[model samples]
Target: MPKPTPETLARMKDVVGPKGFVDDAAEMAPYLVERRELYVGRAAAVLKPATTAEVSAILRIAHETGTAIVPQGGNTGLVGGQIPSGTGEEVVLSLSRMNRVRALDAGNNTLALDAGVTLAAAQTAAEEAGRLFPLSLASEGTCQIGGNLSTNAGGTAVLRYGNARDLVLGLEVVTASGEVWDGMRGLRKDNTGYDLKQLFLGSEGTLGIITGAVLKLFPRPQSLATAFAAVPDVASAVKLLRVADAVSGGMVTAFELVPRIGLEFVVSHVEGASDPLPDVSPWYVLIEMSAGSATAGLDETLEAVLAEGLEQALLSDAVLARSEAQRADFWRLRETLSEVQRLEGGSIKHDVSVPVSAMGAFIARATAEVTRAMPGVRVVAFGHIGDGNVHFNLSQPAGADKAAFLARWGEMNALVHGIVREMGGSISAEHGVGQLKRDEIAATKARVEIETMRALKRALDPKGILNPGKVV
Candidate 1:
């Protein structure tokens, strides 16, 4: 793509005005770097369009000028999907300026919001309406809805509420040619010939730019219960999740696996952390149950599940949070696990998923393979076990060379992904296939499946201008 010509720049500046267009290198720095600092991109300019019409105008100008466009949200993505390329030729289109809650219909349990709305803000809006937007995530405070929907983010509540894709009812997207597909359907039962919204939900902006969304909401829980349990092993934790599901009548909202190493990191790196169990165990699983009514007896239901698990030896010991403060404290440990790992030095992480039945085996096989290849590698196994998604993280061994340990990312990915494929699992369970795993998709996905994705890309974005280099 040609550099933004003076004439083109002039036209673009007029469209969004001085407040929206950012060309100074210093001012555009944040949009160029990802959260982990793993990838730093170069952009000729960053455009902060404030409205859907402004986005269309900018895209139209870019389409006419043959300039590549990289759509960014709060810049919280880990896979380098929102960052521009190193070419310093693309125009970074930021949706932060478009933040707005367009409409909220409590009666319909649907919310129409701008893409720039932060996940936390959207949740607050739903809560204000006496509803629950159950897409909870660690980065909910900073991650924008556009990027969340674009990546189909799977968070803590996937066991019950489902992923970002499941919460979305409709999306208003700007096509490659700058035309808006106003697919803002609020109806739950739409007999549509084609569910085009699904294509863009997890597309990572390769197909189009998600400008607005109509999201599904649920009734707020009147009573909630949380438990932190010590399990002997991953297999036992898996069994415990099933028991909780059965006893709670499938009301288990969140079932997270917490390995011993994860808690160790939290205790060492995080402040005001407390171990939930009296004695340390090899594995831990955080269980949460929620009910729509106060009379549902969530605590009694959790007690039954724990009793059965204890009888079956599914867990060694468990503690249910007696107060809201205790519940928040228990969750703080799980939510901060990812951040605390960074203090332990370099770490390689994989967000993969398998069948609920095979998750335990998958983790065990991958852990064994990884440790055998590299002795002293501290394997941190954890994630949303209820949905079969496990965040298999490998923290650097004690006193090891950080650089040398991090250099094995590719080899580690191959080893772990191989086991995942054997178990009929996805290489990317929650995080989308951004630049990090783009090429790996070719090897992991079937020939026809790969071709079908490429076909859709061509059909929607024949110019290959939207997020050009990321995610096939």
Candidate 2:
């Protein structure tokens, strides 16, 4: 696709208004740089469309001009998928203006809302209706629903709620050719020959843009419980997870694994952050349980599991949060692990997953291999153990050059992802294959799988004008 000319930019600006377009380089700074600082993009204009009609018109102009377009939401994505091109050939489509909750059906437990609405706002809407929107992420406050659905975000609650794809019942999408596909039905079961919504759910804006969605909700939990426990090792952690599942009868909501190094980073970097566990073990697990009724005995159930784990010598020590503030404090330590790692220096982060049973093995083997590759490298490994997704990050050794350490990103990714592939795991567990992992995933996936993805891309986006260099 050719670069968007001045005339094309003017006409595209008319789709919204003068206030809706951001052409100044200084003004588009936030939209240009990704959160991780991994990429810096350039765009002709940041188009903010208030309505789906305006989005359709913008796409129509881009389609006619043969200009590329990148859909951006919240700008909180870590993989640089939301940013536009670095050559200023494409326009950044911002959905922030279309932030509105369209409808909330309590009977169906579905909330149909615009894609621009923030995840936090959607959660608030669900809570107002006496329902629970279980899709919770660290970026929930800033990240919009469009990006979440586009990337199929999986958060701490995936053990019970599932990913963004599972929470979605239907979607309203704007296709590559400027046509609006209204697949928005709040039905539990649809007998349609093809499940079209799945195509755009995790497409990362390559196939189309998600304009709106019918999100599934559940009954709000009345009794909530949280605990921070330390296990002997990865194997023991996996066993304890099974014990929790068995004892809680699946009431366990979030089960996360935190290495000792991660806890130290949080305690040292984040103020007001204290170690939830009295003494640090080799590994830590943060577990939460919630029930729909007050008489569910979630606390008692978690206590029973912890007792059994202690008796079996699987757990070293465990502490249950006594108050809501304490519970939030415990979560604060887990959530801030990603941020505190930056203060430690250059880090190589991987969002990989393996089979639940093989998680311990993968972690153990990958850590050893990576350490051998980069001697003195500090590994800060932690993530949702319940779902087998771990954010295994490698920090620079003390006094090492940050730039030199970061230059080994590609080599480290190859080494770690090779292990992931061997163990039947994904290189990208939750974060989608944006420009960051686009070529990487191609190398890891099978020939038939890559060909199928390419075929689908050709069929849906023939011109390759949407998200030009990302995903397939």
Candidate 3:
């Protein structure tokens, strides 16, 4: 692919106007690098179009000139899908300036907003309207709805409400050809033809640029019951999840797994973090149950579930949050585990998922294999266990060089992913496949499935200018 000509770049800048384009190296630095710093990219410019029309105009120009465009949102992605290429041939089209709350129909339980709206802001908007936007993440404050939609982000609430794709009712996307496809309808049931919005939900900007969305909302919970429990092992934790769901009458909203080592990492690195339980356990499960009615007896349900878990030997110990602050403290441990891992030297992270029945076996086998493969490597396995998605991370051995441990990234991923595949799990669960796992996915995915993805890419983005060299 050829680089965008100076004239083409000029026209692109003119389309966004002065306040929307960034060309200075210093100003573009943040957009070029991701949080993990695994991959750094170079872009000719970063375009921040404030409106759909502006984005359409820019894409129209790029589509005509065949200029590569990368749609970026909040830059909070772990995978390098949002980053431009190292060749400096692409332009980062940022949706940050398009922040807006288009509409909120509380009666219909729908919230429509610009894709650039922060996840936190979207949640706040829904709350102010007496509704709940259930999709959440650790980076909710900085991550944009566009990025969340693009990645199909799955967070703590996914166990109850489903992933990002499930929360969205409609999407307004800018196709690679610069034509705007307005499918932004705030309806619960529409027997429309293709369900086209599903294609871009987790496409990672390879097919189209998501500019606005109509998000599904639910009634805000009037009562919430949170607890931190000590499970003897992962299998016990899974059992506890079943009990929690049964006792709560399917009101269990979040069930997260945290290893003892992960808790130590958080206690050591994060301020105001401490173990909620009295005794140490090999594994911990954070359980949360929410009810829309204030008199739903969530607390009683949780207590009964815990009592049953103890009777069944599923829990060694457990503590229910007596206050909201304590509840927040319990969640802080799970939410901050990803960030605190950085303090523990090099960490090879794998965001994979296995069937709920095989999660324990998969983790045990993967842990044993990785330890045998690389002795002394610390396995900090934890995540949305209710959904069977675990952030199976391996911290470098004590006093080991970070670079050397990181160098074994590919080896570790292969070993872990093999076990995951054997157990009938997905290699990339919450995290989208970006440049990091782009090639490895092709090896694991079925030929027909991979071909189908490629065919879709060709049909939607024939020029291969939208986030090229990333997914597929």
Q: How far does residue 111 in candidate 3 sit from its true spot (Å)?
A: 0.6
- Residue-level lDDT of model 3, residues 1-472, one tens digit each, is 6898889989988998999989999999999999999989999999999999999999889888888998999999988999988999899999999899999998899999999999999999999999999998999999999999999999999999999999999999999988999999987788968799999999999999999999999999999999899999898889889888787789999999999999999999999898887888999999999999999998999999999999999998889999989989998999999999999999998999999978899899999999999999999999999999999999999999999999999999999999888888999999999898899999889999999999999999998889999889
TM-score of 2: 0.99
Q: What is the lDDT of candidate 2?
A: 0.91
Q: Which ten residues in a row have the lowest lDDT in candidate 1?
A: 1-10
Write one digit per residue (lDDT tens) for candidate 2, span 1-472: 7888999999988898988999998998989998879999888889999999999998888888888999999988878888886788889999999899999999999999999999999999999999999999988999999999999999999999999999999999998888999988999898969999998988999999999999999999999999999998988999999998898888989999999999999999999999876675989999999999999888888899999999999998999988999999999999999888999989898999999899889988999999999899998878998898999899999999999999999999999999999999998999988999999878767899999999999998888888988986
Off by over 4 Å in 2: none
Give me candidate 3's TM-score against the actual structure.
0.99
Cα lDDT of all candidates, in order?
A: 0.92, 0.91, 0.93
Clashes of each: 0, 0, 0
TM-score of each: 0.99, 0.99, 0.99
What TM-score does prediction 1 earn?
0.99
Q: Cα RMSD for candidate 1?
A: 0.9
In Å, residue 78's CA in model 1 sits off its true spot by 1.2
lDDT of 1 by residue, 1-472 (tens): 6777878878888899999999998999988998788899998888898999999998898888888999998888888888888998888999999899999999999999999999999999999999999999899999999999999999999989888999999999999989999999898999868899999999999999999999999999999999999999889988988888788888999999988989989988888998988998999989999999999999999999999999999988999999999999899999999999999999898999999999878988998999999999999988999999999999998999999999999999999999999889999988888899999998778899999999999999887889988888
Candidate 3: C-alpha lDDT: 0.93
